[model samples]
Target: MNIQKLAFVILLFISFTICSFPSTSYACKCVEPKSPTKELRESTAVFSGKVIDQLEKGRTQFVLFEVKETWKGLNESQAIVETVNSSSSCGYEFEDGKEYIVYTNETDGHLEVSLCSRTHLLSAASEDLDKLGKGEEPSEQVTLDLSDEDEPPVWMMLSLLVVGFGLAVFYGIKRVKKKVNK
Candidate 1:
């Protein structure tokens, strides 16, 4: 009887473990960005640009950039790059009017960027800048003020709250059941 009870408890534990934690289907996994030389060699394009605007289309966000300088692959004065909207999906959040040193891959003739890329804010890309040396400047400079950005969307906050509540309920029931069993 004791052995049977032990086995039943072990099965219950396993069931709870499996049911309480679900795999995150939307998470992104990426390898670390390589050194500047390796990054330049591997990437299709590398440039500095100021984000002019962002357009959301389905699961992706498109950032329109006014190209300032190019190190490889492109010579256009304007470019559009696509990234997923969710940060968990390795998406890059480009602030409007902010300058960035973007590293990109050419996929189906589209420029793609992610958090895993060596792309970063102009203020934070000193290493890439040092390696790139001098580059041809754009003919015109553009800037915009976007200080009135909105806070986190309501759906995101509500989703987090729901998850938290679910976890709390799960643990609370487990604790009450343990006390009852004792």
Candidate 2:
């Protein structure tokens, strides 16, 4: 190869490598968090609840809470709160069975929380709770018995029974036919 052509190829290779390895950075950063009073004023919902369940769908998480107290938007015994699924995306790490004082905002008609918010585990939020004072019970509280309402619907149970009976009858007929043939 000619010296000029070789130098041009080397430069092109270097340029391509630089472009291919362009550095990308990501992190969850929050400014100085607001005080409890300011957070209370700014938050769309302020409540204390236990994390009953969490469902992660792609980059989003749906957290079910058995709400214990309400200071703002929450009015039901149970609430579903949405959040980013990852901590790198600033999502809160909620533990199943643990309580929390959650400060949330309304996004796209749903409640969302993040590490950037003043939300914290109830064990770590004593100061905020004291500052906020006593919270009220949810206005529309109702307990659902998993033993009853969450059982398979009647149609589903009946379908299972019918399928079981049909399988039993088919096996019985097959056994009788084999015996007669013998």
Candidate 3:
């Protein structure tokens, strides 16, 4: 109920809220543009595959998968790739039994690539020139809405402020009442 105690409580609340917010950037679920080019360069490397499993390392999501067995271009090349899911903004939903092309590169560290929703690359669809209709639309890049990623939400800070002020007011009133009673 003392002023000193109230001030200390407010300070502690502020420090806790700052620590709770996210600091690390999240990886998007979508594939990067240079994935295809990376696939072309290496003769024998882990290019792509379906995500068989996933594990979380701190804030980063680690996607694990086997090599593409029925890949069309590479003549049956296969290798497992691990891509760090950095930001939840770009997080992907992995489907088992689906085929994908993986690309690996060394950036900051040894990093792997994941490109999804590429049914054409995977030999699942039939190849027919005349039978197939020519009205299919081209696929667009998948991008996450990262507008709120950097800043903490406004209401979050406001609520913290309200709670801190309320505590301070309650303590101030209690102190005044104790002095008057004495």
What alpha-carbon RMSD in Å does predicted model 1 have with respect to the real structure?
A: 10.3
**Best-first order by TM-score:** 2, 1, 3
Candidate with the larger TM-score of 1 and 3: 1
CA lDDT, every model vs. true structure = 0.82, 0.83, 0.46
Give lDDT tens digits, candidate 1, residues 1-182.
24456557657876887799896558878886699878889899899988998987657788989898988887778888889898898999999999999999988988999889899999998999999887776554545332334777768997897698568656766776687689
- C-alpha TM-scores of all predictions: 0.62, 0.64, 0.39
Give per-residue lDDT, candidate 3, residue 108.
Answer: 53
Best by lDDT: 2
Question: Which pairs clash in the backbone of model 2?
Answer: none
Residue-wise C-alpha lDDT for candidate 2, range 1-182, written one tens digit per residue: 34455457656865886698776545899999999999999999999999998877647788888999999888889888888877888988899999999999998998999889999888899889889999999989676332223556658987897698567656766676677678
